[model samples]
Target: MDARFLGIPELAEAPSVAVVIDVMRAYTVAAWAFAQGAEKIVLAESLDDALALKARHPDWVALKDGPPAPGFDAVNSPGLLRSVDLGGRTVVQKTTAGTVGALAVKEASLVLCAGFVVAEATARILRSRGCDSVTFVVTGEDGRADEDLACAQYIARRTTETTTDATGFLRRAGASRAATELTEGVRRGAHPDDVALCLELDRFRFAMVATLEDELMVLRPHDVPSPTGTAAA
Candidate 1:
């Protein structure tokens, strides 16, 4: 098997099995929502589309990354989602990088949204597929967001049965500019726990898989079995 690490710019030409990683917050929020028992999540291309979807389905929970919008339930903050009872409800998500990266990959046969919160499960799912090639789309722009790239490295190493330096990766991730900025946001009264929650590794045990349905990028959890071929406890 071959694994190649790329960024958002290379997403369109990604190989058959691809994992779109957004460790700063997006996919981490999705993981928490699923852990809270959300039925499914729709990855909206834009905030406008997310609002429209919320309008169409009043029962669906609309989530975004910006200031409050009309009819939106909440922002994409995993720390905030812990209090909500999301059981059996649909979630419509909009974010600048994560959702865009998930939708931009047109050639991948399989697409999965990932973060450090679900990194181990992401690797488990990829390994079980037995695919020839896998592409890790670190959804950060240019050389920014080193945390996402570190996550890709960890998942890649895990999926290929190679040794990974989790501690070193975590150190690199914590010192990144993205981490610093988000931490600054916390001091300004944003979701204070978001940065901490997002950095927690392997917090969830399921992989969030995305599939295009009626032009919507729908995300649902795919449970990854243990190396012993049974459900992870």
Candidate 2:
């Protein structure tokens, strides 16, 4: 198995498996929704696409970044999911970086949207697949190591080295611009628990796999048995 770390811009060059990370919020929100029992999630290319999907299935829950749009149920905030029951409901989510990056790579056999919350599970899934090549897409990378990049680094390392502690990379993430803004966002009335929620390593036992079902980019949680018998950190 070989692993490559790539940014979202180079998604086309990705190989068999791609893990697109949006640790600051998007993927974290999805994990939380799944934890709350969401049936499936659709990663829309744009808010309009999400709205259209929602219109077709009016009962579907719609979540987007920032403030809620006209048809969206709420913003993609993990804290908010704690109170909602997403059981047996479809969720449509659109975001500036995460969803766009996740939908960009079309060639990979397995594509996963992830964050710190699903890092260990994502790695376990990769290990179980015996992937020949895998790329971790740093969705928010911009010549700086931010939360997404930090998560990719952590997942890639955990994929091959289960014994690797996440302390160092997490320390780096804590100081990154994205994490800094998250804390500030909380102070400025963003979800008070979002920052902590986003950084909770391996919070879920499953990984959210993005699959092209029919014409929709659907995301569903997958539980892959640990290949190395590794326990969650």
The lDDT per prediction is 0.82, 0.82
| Residue-by-residue lDDT tens digits, candidate 2, 1-233 | 67777777665564678888888788999988888888999999888888999999999999888865589897877887778998899999898788888888755788988999999899888887787788777888541447777788888888888899998877777788877876777423247788788889988888889989987889999886665565433
Model 1 C-alpha lDDT per residue in residues 1-233, reported as the tens digit of each score = 68777777765465788889898788999998988989999999888888899889999999888666667898877778878999999999988789888887745789989998888888888778887788888887642579988888888888877466578877788887777877887423237787788889888878889998887889999888877777853
The Cα error of candidate 1 at residue 84, in Å, is 1.1
User: Best TM-score goes to which candidate?
Assistant: 1
- After TM-score superposition, the amount by which residue 214's alpha carbon in candidate 2 deviates from its true location, in angstroms, is 1.2
RMSD of each: 1.9, 2.5
Error of 1 at 142 (Å): 3.9
Error of 2 at 80 (Å): 1.6
